[model samples]
Target: MLNRFLLPALAATLLTTACTEPPKTVAALPILGERDVRPRADGGPADTVYAAVPAFRLTDQAGQPVSNQTFAGRAYVTDFFFATCPGICPKMQSELLKVYKKFPTDPRISFLSITIDPDHDSTAVLRDYAQRLGIGDASRWHFASLGDRAKSFELANHLLTGVVPDSLAPGGLAHNGTLALVDDRGYIRGAYDGLNAGQVAALQRDIPVLLAEIDGRKKGVAKK
Candidate 1:
């Protein structure tokens, strides 16, 4: 009869609808680097801890000592730039400002702009630069110095982003034009080209995803 045929078709449509629903958002961001690996006691395979930015101490624009601990429970965007750069640094900052404006006053997020030219960008210089940029909130944004030239280069080239001294370069130093997104746990979640509007927008999108992932984990633990 028509009732029997219609019932089966309705069931089929319902099944199809159930199957087509989008899956839940899962945070599966790949951990960068393979060095933080260890062998399992059961001898199955080595486990990777996922590379994390090592602890560092630096002086912020306010002449205050800040370290990795400063961002212990906050997600942050980081980039390397000197105050007087005549090239892409300005563009990078302009893009980063968009991200900042999007999350302004959100204590869960912060920004770090570390200077590669620390010798010339002293605390006073950084403070002045920050002021000019309208960065009135020191807690949310920091312009810092690594203090040591070799350490600065090491951090720029190895830890956060790429940087190299070049006499022929526009700013006396060549550096990556990307911004690094670090999760609350100190792991680098993602990197976006700070000079590209599209990539910067992607960075903004990923920030909430990372924050949601952290929130989900916390709720899971609480339910246990």
Candidate 2:
């Protein structure tokens, strides 16, 4: 028969072993889209470059010019919404705010809310919206307008793959309700459903992974 002392000691040893086990490895996030792909000159096979957010110049809520350069060397999350949107826009913003709050003071991350209704969402209008959202840091969170409705839609649909205009849809627009995660190189690394809590939670978890990847790349370049 097993001794009482041996049973207790064995349980303690099992608990200790479980506590000392190595952590499970986490998979890295994936780069998204194929817009940047190109055919090889040799015509052997097409080479695919990771899709990147292209350069753009737009006016911020402060009436300041903001461009892709504004986020150079930084990772950012982006979505499209109009000030007067009555449907998904508010939900999308609320979801995105969770992400913004997650990295409230982290300079390495930024957030962009681009307006699809540029004619209505001027700099002043964007400013008022920012105020309504209680956005305290204009530098970290920008409400911007492309100032051209067609171009805005193009950027939303083609570049960011987020929004689409719908005359019959509520708020005169329909969007994918996605929050795009862009890496430092401007490549899109992930896109999360802005309307779903579970997807947003995944986005929150993935941001740190992308940041760590950026740090790793920097360290590699330094070593070379």
Candidate 3:
């Protein structure tokens, strides 16, 4: 319901039930076709194109340096999370963990769990958090430090895709469980709400296709 990017829920339900196949069950994503999950940015005639990522440096869960440069030449699944959240964070994380395990042996893909509450979700806190979630592997999956509240908030607005931090008062910032797909060139290819198992599975299926596309293109160029 949060993401009406597809269609009205009633229509979606009707369409999904009318067709047995997952591809035909749902409508076309803003960017991906019924069967294709790889972002169609450069492919032309795809759903949409992504904007280039900006340059910025931050820390990792291990307190190491990380930047937009960090994601360059790599593909990954990214999401925003906080150490202390009650509403959808738990369920959302549960779903994301399913995705983390999906590509257990995938060397070409990585996972980026960016914490919105950087102040509370420090390196040690994030490390503990990952352990609690039973994340697959540290090397394959990572949690990034989003700097301070000011920078994190700004980045979310600029990127127009992540987080809504809260005030220290009564309630917290409104959070969404969307997982973003970033390409090897540091461009955002697509996004999905990780709270939905069906959507997550769809995303899992698409990642390999995107990787294969890039790899194939590289090979073709090398031959030329």
What's the C-alpha lDDT at position 113 in model 1? Answer: 90
**Most lDDT-accurate candidate:** 2
User: Candidate 3's residue-wise lDDT over 1-224, tens digit each?
Assistant: 56685568778899879887655343222332123335575866655444555676767766777776666666777777778877777887888788778787687788877777777888888888888887635666787777687677666544434555557522386767778777777666667787888888888887877787667767887999
For candidate 1, the 10 contiguous residues with the lowest summed lDDT are 27-36
Candidate with top TM-score is 1
Please list the residue runs of candidate 3 whose C-alpha ends up more than 4 Å from where it truly belongs after superposition.
1-50, 158-162, 165-171
On a 0 to 100 scale, what is the lDDT of residue 47 in model 3? 53
| Residue 55 alpha-carbon offset, candidate 2, angstroms | 1.2
Per-residue lDDT tens digits for candidate 2, residues 17-79, read 989969868668877876556788888888777767878999999888889999988898988
Give lDDT: candidate 2, residue 16: 97
Sorted by TM-score (best first), the order is 1, 2, 3
Model 1: what TM-score? 0.88
Candidate 2 is scored at a TM of 0.84
Candidate 2 Cα deviation (angstroms), residue 36: 6.3
Residue 8, candidate 2: Cα error in Å is: 14
